[model samples]
Target chain A: MKNRIITISREFGSGGRTIGKKVAEKLGILCYDSELIEKVASESGFNANYIKDAGEYAPGGFLSSAFSHRSSGPNNADYLWTIQYKIITELAEKGPCVIVGRCADYILREKADCLRVFIHADLSFRAERIVKEYGEREESPEQRLKDKDKRRAAYHRFYTNMKWGHAQNYDVTLNSGTLGIDKCVDIIKELY
Target chain B: MKNRIITISREFGSGGRTIGKKVAEKLGILCYDSELIEKVASESGFNANYIKDAGEYAPGGFLSSAFSHRSSGPNNADYLWTIQYKIITELAEKGPCVIVGRCADYILREKADCLRVFIHADLSFRAERIVKEYGEREESPEQRLKDKDKRRAAYHRFYTNMKWGHAQNYDVTLNSGTLGIDKCVDIIKELY
Candidate 1:
């Protein structure tokens, strides 16, 4: 009913980005997915590749090139977080927009107006999505799912210093793979 | 009020266990926390020590000492899940209770009477709790908090295939450290 901010976290193939785009369009609002990345890169003056790299490093991810080797030290965390916080806070202050990932829900935890949604699908459905999206890739469905989730988990963990998918962490956890994307959006629209 | 179940996810050292115990005592129901390990130990035939070790694997934790790892295959996830699922279902079927930690909220998501709550305090408050709990052997609150949470995240992820601590996963997220335990419980009780 009011101008609102909604943050979404979804599995790679769950159509979270697609659904977020649709919801923003339906509501006649701007949606931030890749755009948020660009803003994050521009605000931090970091290479888009680095922002993209750090974006993949969610809370659970440990940069093997850094943390594993014990070679990274403070600079890595500090450098990446600068952009992470800057982009997320700016977007929050900017206006209502749909964020696909980057733990936007956790990023805006203190904001009273934000509604956080966790969108997920069954393994089979998500696997099918990966298969369709990357038909050229030789990797199996299971391997693709694993890689995407691992990166997602790692990125979330490194940033927030919290676990990635505990249900207690989210506002609404749904099995979108089974419910279908539109039905999921309908339910979320009702929730908002 | 009708009988119901409350799922709690808390920051380490925030006295979530104390808060959960008190709430369960008030509601006249069982509180499942560490008890989950024992049940998993029994049902899965894995020793409690091994289950604890399996949990400690911490993300890539499995790659570290997985030889003794207690739940290797996807079917098993991790050792703690068997216990978590068993306890959650048993309690839900038995009637309402307060289930704490171990991703009880996610496991019991199917139940109609479930109320998921995340109780978190500021770092200083959690640090104080850990300091009090460990006494002379106590480590700095931040380190203790990180280790404890990593273990928790690993256990939940290995078992449920879900990330931990993201806000989108829970129904209501509250600042327990700021609100204090009594107020936290009271607010949850009112919501329930």
Candidate 2:
């Protein structure tokens, strides 16, 4: 495990963040999720909420991508991507760590030895988890799941020019609904 | 381990067949690759060679699928798919085994507890292995690789209505080029 970087890209409410944290704890490494957003916010002088939103979700969004092409020159998403990329790389360089989301997999792909993992689950499973995790909202869990996943995917595609969850791009892709969060962590740990 | 079924879908020249055999050997279970093809051919009353081609490759090919829908009645591929579906289902019912290719993953999607695995490698890695495995051919290895992968994908898509090699469809997707064949085997074995 010389290149001890693990980048976890996960679907919303798939328990990917939990799995990442558990694996990092087992490996005695830092798991960067919200910590990453804070870092980017600090580095880019943007509000933490703004960085969290724009960093992962696309501006025009997955459904409204019909109007994404209108902007030009270092847009907010692009700027946040640049800053996040630098911070992710620096974090990888700093030491062995687990990075969840923000395309750390793509950012550190060539720069570091990374065990890039994509975590996903069935829509029903995700929808249930989101309700329990985020609490009930006006929007149904399924609809919220769809919107968030689409935006994240759009962001990944827009920034990296790669299909967000395409198996080919990652070293391993795990179905958390089938495999379960604990098993997913165990698998990542086994590979780690 | 109650499911006792492992379905392996792979890109050409990824050593997926070899990996499946090794895993089966280690698990003391049957690895169905050529044996499955033979069974399909026997049951369908088609030549083994024809079954090998049509069972895994789409008619009109992947690159040239503009004319794929001209036929109305059950065509050769559809017929082969039916036989394959039957044989694969029966194999799973028999016991735990590693079933390779022919859309076994999709066929047994709900019928059995299958550890569906997709194996893929970089184009360059596959190109190098094809020459070693299949021997030199008039067509370049890369071209052959492209043609084969496309047809396999087309066939899987046509029959299953699922995207070939999509991560969402599998429990685990491994990159043989990065993880190496041995590591891939060990990971699958660990999960099993």
RMSD values for the candidates in order, in angstroms, are 9.8, 2.1
- Recovered fraction of real interface contacts per model: 0.15, 0.79
- Residue A121's lDDT within candidate 1 is 73
Worst 10 residues of 2 chain B by lDDT: B59-68
lDDT of each: 0.68, 0.87
State the weakest 10-residue window (summed lDDT) of model 2 chain A: A59-68
Q: Write the per-residue lDDT of candidate 2 for residues A132-178, one digit (tens) a residue.
A: 88899999898998888888888888778899889989989999998
lDDT of 1: 0.68
